[model samples]
Target: MRRARTSFGALGAVTSVGVLIALIAACGDDRGGFIKNDRAFETQSEGGAPDAETCLLQCSLDGRSIIDSCTGGVVETCADDLACGAAKCQEPCAAAEADRSSNGCDFYFTQPLSAYPFASCFATFVVNASNKPATVSLELGGEELDVSGALFRAVPNSTDLELLEGPIPPGESAILFVADWDPTIPRSLGERLYHTSCPTAAKPAIQADGYFRSGIGDAFRLKSNVPIGLTWMYPYGGAGTHFPTATLVLPVSAWAKEHVVVNGWEANVGEPVTQIFAAEDDTEITIFGSKDVTNGVGFAGATAGMPAKIMLSKGQFVQIAQSQELTGSLVFSNKPTATVGGSECANLPSKAAACDTLAQQIPAFEQWGSEYVGIGYRPRTANTEEIVWYRMVGGRDGTELEYDPVKPAGAPTTLSAGELVLFRARSNDAFVVRARDAEHPFYLGMHMSGADGEESDSPSHGGMGDPEFVNVVPSGQYMSSYSFYADSSFSEHSLVIVRKKTHGAFKDVWLECAGNLPDWKPIDSAGQYEYRRVDLSRNFGPGDSFGEKRCTTGLQRMRSEGAFSATLWGWGKYASYAYPGGTAFRKLVEIPLSPVN
Candidate 1:
């Protein structure tokens, strides 16, 4: 027999009187008015406890009051007029409970070791998107981090250290720097002759909690007062000289049973890696390699044109590193899972002077967008135009693509499922991509160019930035507001924004540090949408080297009266990172279930 369960958190607040009236009608009056202690009671009776089943029946009839009273475990307080004698309440009550339990929340990270351990820096920024203040904390391998003192620190210039153990105000954010714990040890006597600090850092433990704990190869469990917007940034690479990247972190509601990783940085220069983390136990996974995966011999012998299989338990992950490109690879699982792909460090155009790490969580095909706006990064110097690389992958065969302001050379007119095309646009160029319709959604990614050997200290270099990868947020997923972070480690930072020209909020859009966004440029002759670039800081060379003293850059907030999309990025000499400001993770497609062998 099924045990009776309380409906405390399962039911949402009742919205209307009509719903209550309808439920009462469904129960009918012929069954008798009220059931008190298993005995019939007068409709006007004010006292006596109602039977559990009967109380639930009345809960559906009187809106929230009686439901709240009964679910609060005070059964005697149930209203007598709720017609608690009904025998038909069990089914609907059970259904409501089942629906609530089905919802889940989990998050994953992809912070692989960089080419040089000393160059690795990982951080996560989270914003309370809800109206209420949010209490946020993190857990790894089942043990919670001491957010109050160990992992979190006060933001840049803010003295409110309490925000670290927040009740962070609505629209505010909490930042976590993994390096705070000191991933490296003090230099030894013998090594002091050759090295200034520890020569190498320790690998993140598979299971542990405390200072020096690495988040690598683990799932991050975020507990918060409400839904949040998250972004992961890995700044500095290659002996702390070059390579940096970032990505928007999708919530568990966006996890799917299938996904296709978009291409990473130039495939020939450095190791291209892909990591898949499971959110459930015994998740069976299959990989259809799009390139000759270098490490294929180990993980089910994955190879180009061949399928590989494996299984992962909750919080466990499998990392695949190779020299070949992993773009177009398909990841399918029996249960929902998350995947992140990129290169440890790569050169743009495959032959650029400097390389940067490229990393972004792959959104499931269900979240692909049918329309996108491509905007390039602001020029490195007032005179030099930055070239941005854009790639689009098809979600369905025969997908037709339309571009405004004249499509560039190499742009495809059509694409087959799992196929992709790459093109280039100048920093000042802004364009729109539209599919035949919502039925032909596609994925879009933007790549930054390398610094081309520009010196960091050159007064005219404008803080030359290197290659980075960022997944473009679809116009369909735009939100009215966003709270993000800009790392001071970078010498310059900026935001690229796109919004409908018809949106009334366009003129009202504002950034926290900067005032109203100005200088909006329309895309081509369409006049349907517009784009703008706002710099948070410009050409400001690195400040204090210590973590706590870097106050020139930190959290940024933006909002509008209507929906809009934005991307946040920052760059230092030979290094850079970029990520979507925020996006809604509505499921846009469905994946058919596959049997596990």
Candidate 2:
């Protein structure tokens, strides 16, 4: 809901608004009991500004400044056509005004000399706004860019305001300031928040993943072909699904062959597991469950959506019944003395070579299976320091977890038998740390597709066709079609999904990281140059094929008004871009394939 404020004479002398609703009822007379006469009356009183010119400027009913007034104190009002403006003004006006009248919103940043060598830097303001019936335009360093609207609605009398440019409408907020770029690109080193519509208090309860960075360069020069693992720390425990802690004690050999290529690079992955030799104390809790060892029979594990049979499985390999592959890339370092730039890796030498010696690796395939396990934990406290950490268990597959608190002398708790034992992380970092998946003797970075003879300071990144995902277009524009598949085959009667409010000219999208949902970094940091893919597919009930070759109603409602939080994540391989009818395609290949296994 949108809220407006009214003051008496000063901004501090504010009064609360109360809306009084009125209701009326007809009087009825029975027999002749004092039913001689009846009267009707009604009245309404509300704490709102009066509808008059005086009310527009100083609000005669309340004495606050007319916030939405135009030049000459012309009162501006929000009607059906002003929803976006109304929403924008809800809190920003109050907050921006407070900022403008204060000591300023500049931050005190201190960094190592190596990271930022320049002596000093100045803050630049770039505003992009359209006054609608008025005008809007944008300029930088006295140069006019190809902006479409008039640019008059900027700060007029304030120096600080002049330094910061925009007064753009809420709709164009994404383009107000692209980035605080330096004219001279630094040889190396870089770094850089937004308001959440959700209440600040409520956000603490919402679990979030930390945006992890490995700090590896995009190219690697290798002398020998040794197995190097590229990893990003999860920082916490169980994500949407796939618990790792239960699989830890199954022996390291069990996970050696279970490698999977995430974001196009091979990763040695496995689930985290824990075990107990014998019941030690009553404070210890053990969770128990069983495995369904039906050969050649596969069903979807507990994950994000509906359960479907495995599209393909073999020996110990299971595929999600789709053609899209899940993968991540590797970055390489030039300094032989530095392992992946000497951050995550340990071993190093003193030489360098051409950056194309390393080749991308894919995981071997395995037939799917389920298992039962027991879990135990101790009580935890807020003061726990270093209480959360990630370690390697077996394969690249891992589970994020936290240490249980120490129970009293004799109060061990355990879950003995259950279909599945799910664990939840209580702390923010606990949810992301995967001890098993992150297990590696060392870390390394490399360019996956091979090396280009370009300098490290080159402006252009190495590859061009890194598979652009997540492309958001404006309303009424065409969205390319992508493929969709269920884990287990459904007879088509289980569910139906649709995209709502998914239209608009998206300006802040990270297009490079499309398709792979888990690969997406949170859209929080401003200067991060990454993108996420938007999967344009859905499911439906039996006999509900959209067409012989496609699923209908997939991208139809992308622009409707009811849409707000437009989010999509899934996986599949790219098919033909311009297929029949101009639709793009992504197909999930049959699992246990030769290239991956």
Candidate 3:
């Protein structure tokens, strides 16, 4: 999805009210202006200036400006071919091609699907509120779904979805896949999708890994003119008729460089894996405690100390594998990088043949907060208790620990660099972890047991009882309001966890549940914020499509008093998964307790 700086909000809307803004693309309108398509829509930022944000400068062919893009900015009349953009001028493309210096309509870029984790994969989309054709990435490899395929809302939910190229839309939803590798288009982006963590002037290009790779798993670079939510899944390994494994891939704008990865696989007693993809090149990365740091105690995949230093070219990546629990392993980079970590296949201590998979793109260190209030994950089977674990990263020598609804934590007076303290809890345990001081700002994550009790026959086939990872983020980084995507078009099934930023931060936690997710309850309230749990089912999922409904499987907003964060959960066939529903804008700090905006 192409999200431009417009009136639209950061995340897509909870309600589908029309938000249209006809902005032209950079091309010939001959009036010396840009000629854009109807697909353009603008969004309004919540705390931004009353006016919509200005557009980035695109040059004019004749070195002229039909209109200035922003107030007081340069009129930019350069014929520089190196100029990445141009105005959507009044002239037509056919006529503009005559000018050698013009960079016409180059904004129309396509994303190609290359290799994949499964022979066949399915993609479900949540289109931008913009009612344009951008319901999904227009290109899948070289093949494009019929533009009309986006109209899933008008189509009855009773229709067999597998037969359709995509769900119908007015910015509703859609599905796509590459049955084989042949649909490859002109490589929209090179080997990697996003740029490396380094800048061009600083080092070489570092490309990212494939969107859907086998052991490496799936990921997406959500760089779009129109905003949309995407969750792709593997057809096998799941229990029900639907695909088993699925996760929401955060947009590139949400990616970060440093991550305190928790190896959920360790809890399953299985080997753990973590993958780092460069957002920039010559990206010098240091992997602490992976193989390099802990002798053989770390990952088997590490190359350098192999834990201490990892040098990745633009878009390059390395998957760190470790047989032991990566107790407090840390990954740091000279610059920003994108990291994904989890177990390839892990079974909770049960030893079930059904070792389901787990993974999440870890957010950058900036998203880490000094405080965290955690709610336990539901156990996979009734009578079977869910084992929950918490890992605290980035605490210091003087770092103190505080807890509520308390349990036994050996509060240590000090913690060394790259050292993390781990805590384990049973199902439904409500607890809080806050560094006594901000100087020890840290992060928290949770791991739930595999689906041992989740299904009856699930273990006989592909996988069973796999542990899953969930990110409990810093409320300070949460969205004041945001929406989530449905896990499946079939049986309704969804749950979301939300917590307001500060005490009495908002009058109410939910604006509305969109009717589908009709149940909610206050879980924990003693901490700085209260957490409300919400649920939605197939009746509330993508069925009988009027389009996305309330509780689009998420919490929409908190009264403006403050911000809130969310994590969404969904299950299919036999597997379970969850992802942070909000975006992150982390600010790297050189010092602990540094003032963060």
Candidate 4:
């Protein structure tokens, strides 16, 4: 019983004769007389004749009622006030014929900062969770792009505008290298090569991610099956320096015009940046800045507590960076848009020596959840405790939050709309958070501890881990199965899984690499939910300083009898990346935008 809300435009236009035949065939009654309901067909002509397309569109909008009538061998008359010639009457009549489930089919991608001097080898891992092999393609502004010979390669060079297609087997994944760089070449040399090979009227300065050409900033469309999941990552970065980050790519169906950025790290330690991408033309966006936004164009400089407006078309985007943290900033658009927030390189607690690049696609306020299970990364060493930081942002005014075991020190019990709070916890100290109800949902973020050598006197004691940010998927949005990728570039890869014990024991869960997740621990005394930390691969040590490993162990598939949530993360010497395994992208609320002053 899926409902189609948006206009199909010219795609829905059909010949009047064809529509008439469909209406006649669908409206026939056993008594040889037309079924008529005055309430449903009030908009019919004075002669009691229905408009072909309007009637079909109305029936589609009626959803379950029309289906029920048809199942009971009764055909209810369908009509709408919209004229058949009007654009509103032009709807996809086929929408009512079948249910179109969201397999994460259509989505857009954006690259965050990887820092200068670091090789920006951007790649997206598409996992086919369907039963049938799926074809994957990328497009920008209606033009297909080439990704031939780019599968699983760190650095790929492809010709422009060439349509390249690939298939991903069911329960397996394929890597698409959208942007790549030759690490042997220095940043300056790479920039020169890019400009010489693809010169254009506007030569924008080289980005922190080291992407100097066009199309990198443009939002590219990824088409695939509805059950697929995408994880975007920059596999390589400066050795023993700025680390890379990964984030789950939210599909276009999950996108919204309104979002709020949660503070992941201290702004003073490094530059905090935010980016917005438009999926449609003529999109007007307004940002209510929580901090001063610098290095942005097409809008006036935004000061803290001020508003900035910008316009974008399909595939177009704007990146905004600032010295101050942009947490709690409100982004509103006239059309649905995707927003990403993070830092170029930020130190946790603002005192850790090592900093890592952070990135997470901000979900719409409507998708915020009232319940979340907070789990940290695995311990850096066998003896050391796994310490992590958590940040929660409120999506509504007067949102009240409650913790299952006990609230950590300095955690807030209540928050105003767009307010943010931070707290610390240990890896094994798992807890559940619940708001007053679903109406007062909030966003939760997890941050890995920096490699500050606190565990031992040596500076490299905690060198394998660093500050990284990953959004905590809501418990309600957990899916039963997931196909995700773990970058082989990282020495250690693991998954944090949480499932309801009431539905079934954790033993019911199955992973392609590790069967039945042998390790399970309870979160609280209630015994309703249980969690486990499973290692996919661990080769971190002296020889593997750069976090490189065999590519065969990168893709992973997991399933459970009931809904469960999982987080994929890995770390090596001063490098780490984390993101959710997948999300259902269910709409939980409707958050209105604030009036622009």
Candidate 5:
């Protein structure tokens, strides 16, 4: 089996279409029709036994004894003067020459060949003449590299598979064993084997250990093209069946499947084509179908107790026929609502109206894609009347606790403070968020200190006091935005967290006046005082040092209008960031949030 890209959309109960470019192999032009003769059985003598003289064939030109047969006590041999198999054996022959086909075709084998060295290389293949139904057994060793599926492409010119099955009349069935031992080589890529006895003319099936490696167990390796996200690992694990034109799954449960229409196109069952785009709470993926798909097909697989299997870690293996040409669409089962400002935040003026909360309506299958990271809007402070966008710079968990709250080396700064900066990065977690166009503005907010718990320090922020009014309270939830960026020097980085209000133990407070962001409407500008309870248990921080420490900002304004609308950016706990400049990026903060929500 081959490893492929992971899929994020509703893989089960879904039929995704794929397209592939054609591959051609070299041959003289005679693409078909080769025949086999009776010479294959000419060696047998009368009474179905070889005569003594007939059994003792000639040897090679050098006169060396060629092995004929080894009976109970006799070691029969051939003369060395004969050509081994390659030519008529008039005399004894030396070792047999490598096997070759009638049309000057040489035998070859294909299998993986390295130990995960991380490159594209060829696996070793060997050719031999063995006409038997072969059974291959694979065992895992050395770090256990994953295999997708194994297949054999038939040689273009040869008699029907019956020849490989030993003439197919009683004395038939000779199987050959081919071995592939490299971890870095790709076997099923583009090679074909020559055999006349292939059980059926159809393609062979591929198998993977996606579900139940042994008996029922719950451990599974994370699979995805996105940097960070986790799929539930039911004991059954993940798996998908293949079809000539599409990889379709009809979810057994009706609730998991969703239907929608976009741009006037409706999704109908069993259509030759279909397209779906990703939604905010769902992973950012597009699904296309080559044939009309229905829940009935997918439901059968799911009801059979199959794990919610999708494609592999990558979606490349899910091939679709090119003729179908599907246009897919994506819609959230639950839509996300944006929140605008009011008295909910202490730093804002009592009458200011510019904060927006872009909250998601968590769906049954909770998933989020962050096209941009650390993105959000916040006020200057509780005492000021202006709104600005504060972003996350460089941060770290240090795998321990430390104290200090200064800017880290290469940390980014706003060219103009309070000037809405459109920063981008993975969320504290690493979901992917995107914009329809670069010009469209995003929504924003900030955090502020509250009355009772506004004067203590936590270890997450370099042991320095947490952002004035925006301390991390044990049980409060805050909505924010994020952006990730790398500079030309390859040494600078940033992670910014902006919130509307803060209410836990912290060090200071600010008074900021605010207005709505420049070009967006609010879902509830008047009732903006709603409170949501949250537990950020997995986040890293309490340190105050900006360098090597988590960076944060409290409310910069109560309601300052801007040109962008607010949106939510979330990344699960384990996400990796890849800086554009070829430098490796790792998560410095966990965002301290619980998954219970």
Candidate 6:
């Protein structure tokens, strides 16, 4: 059901392309549907003189110069296979890389900077592996900030707010802030888009948490002088109507242009917020929607509807703001791109519980797996325990779908390609959601109860735990080790949950936060795999950064046998969030099952 992919005409008319996708466009007002992007050609240099043998330079189908044949500069990370050649060599990560735990990495693994779907409030921390001090810079909320004299110790309280307040140190460790920190304001961190709650280098160090608005859908970039490990959180503190606190450990350089579907939060009231980032300049993204449920060009594996087809360019982003329940929309891009989805705040069954914000950057279809263990979360709400719901999207009509431990009667057993379905489980129920045979590979996600909804008619998010979301980790993407931050805010802070992706049990499991994991009690029901919540908050204090742990929350590290899926959960006060656990696993490219010919 994939469309013609891209109009990928040659360069400009002065350029050479097959179809006429305006190499020069005006704000996507042209007929070709290419979003006008001032940054589109950033990665390509001007052409050099052509040799007699051949031009040696050719424009990519997407209308980009493959190798500045004119300048003698080849696109950065082309592979020996020639696959990573011209068309996809839009990123520079191929040239610079840092040490990694896993081996399958490629140019797309480690770069000096990393990109993630943006959120205004996140409890973030970092680790410096450089021997000399490192300076971390941030681009957020419409400002540029830098941190200085950063030192790292294998201990806690390594960072002091006073130290971060300025004449910053070099090569040392400290927590950075770029917020409107006005202690006088009650809705500072949670409600307002003030504190990224993230540890940034420094942007006018001590500022008060400002207005309630935030740059929620903006693309955020973190640049560092040295190879460093960074992690951020949509901590458990809920604001006004923002619900479902979540956490994600991004592989700074691990970005892909192709993503399948990232599900939304709650049901009726939950509007989907989609954020897409172009890794390379002048990149083109043609989004497809299964939710449209149509059959046409660009309608290949989709069914969702939208405004005239949308397009994107380098460094630019597109946000759906708040759209209809598009939890099942599909985005198809010609270049490597990154995506995240959820809601600014949402509730289930419209009248159920309170609201919470949701967000997660998901892997593309090529990276998706067929098996999953469904272990839901228990927020403070609900009478008994918690429930887990699965949003499954198929690629073919009548695709066979099933579950383990049994699903409710009349539950869905089939899916049409591009069809999206949200299936709810009984209270506190846990089960395995898989295809009858594995022919129909689909995507799945989980949700948590936003509020206790006990006796109060009030919407959930108030002092009740807000809704929580985390995509069901596919075993195929599982890694043996990961580097991340563990929130040290003891009260209601961040926790790590680990389980097998399928029937296989994993061994050699280890969690290192500050020190090695002292506890990992087995939890319940994730079907056949390991289930445990590891808490590292006990090892950190206010503004504390364990230098030994690279100044990150607890610098939690994990290693296990067999393929396992792990996720980090944020739960504190009335807010909470969740996201899949991942390593900086590198790859040559993140494309589709079928090449974009």
lDDT of 6 by residue, 157-226 (tens): 3332334433213223333332223344456333354233323433422232221111112233556554
Writing each residue's lDDT as its tens digit, candidate 1 over 1-597 gives 111211100001011000000000000011111222211111111111111323322222221122222353423332322222222233222221211111112355535434433323345566554345656566554456554542243346432333254476655665554322122346445433321111123221111112111111334555554445666555322123355567776656557788886757645566776777676777788877777644332245455766677666555455666666677777888898877767767777676657766777777777677778888877777776566788788877778887887786677889887787878777688887778665677889988777773333222333377778878877655544566666555667777888653222244566665556667788856565688777666555422222232324566666653446778777777778787766655444444322223
Ranking by TM-score: 4, 1, 6, 3, 5, 2
Predicted structure with the largest lDDT when compared to the true one: 4
Return the number of clashes found in candidate 6: 79
Per-residue CA lDDT of model 2 for 570-591, tens digit only, reads: 1112100000001100011122
- CA-lDDT, candidates in order: 0.53, 0.15, 0.39, 0.55, 0.17, 0.40
Choose the strongest candidate by TM-score. 4
Q: How many residue pairs clash in each candidate?
A: 1, 86, 79, 4, 168, 79
Which parts of model 4 have CA positions greater than 4 angstroms off?
1-103, 117-119, 140-142, 153-166, 182-217, 225-227, 236-242, 453-460, 501-507, 540-552, 591-597
Q: Is candidate 5 or candidate 6 better by TM-score?
A: 6
When 1 and 3 are scored with TM-score, the better candidate is: 1
Query: Comparing 1 and 3 by lDDT, which wins?
Result: 1
**What local lDDT score does residue 86 receive in model 5, on the 0 to 100 scale?**
22
Q: Give the TM-score (vs. native) of candidate 6.
A: 0.61
Across residues 1-597, which tens digit of lDDT does each residue of candidate 4 receive?
111111110001111000000000000000111123211211222111223422222122222123221233323432332111111221212221111112356767655653442334455666664445667666644557564554432221111122224566655565565443333345465444322111122111111122311111345566764245677665332233246677777766667877887645667455776767777877888878777755343456567667777777676666666667778888889899877777767877677768776778778877777878887767778776666778888877888777777676677889887788888777778988878766788889988867784334223334677878988877656555566666555677667888754222343777665556655787855555678777666773212111332222355666653456778777777778788776655566645646546
Once superposed on the true structure, which residue ranges of model 2 sit more than 4 Å away at CA?
A: 1-166, 173-597
Top-down lDDT ranking: 4, 1, 6, 3, 5, 2
Q: Which 10-residue span in candidate 6 carries the lowest summed lDDT?
A: 21-30
Candidate 2 vs candidate 3, TM-score winner: 3
- Looking at candidate 3, the ten consecutive residues that score lowest on lDDT are 17-26
Candidate 3 accuracy as lDDT: 0.39
The alpha-carbon lDDT assigned to residue 132 of candidate 2 equals: 24
At residue 18, give the lDDT of candidate 4: 5
Model 4 lDDT at residue 20:
4
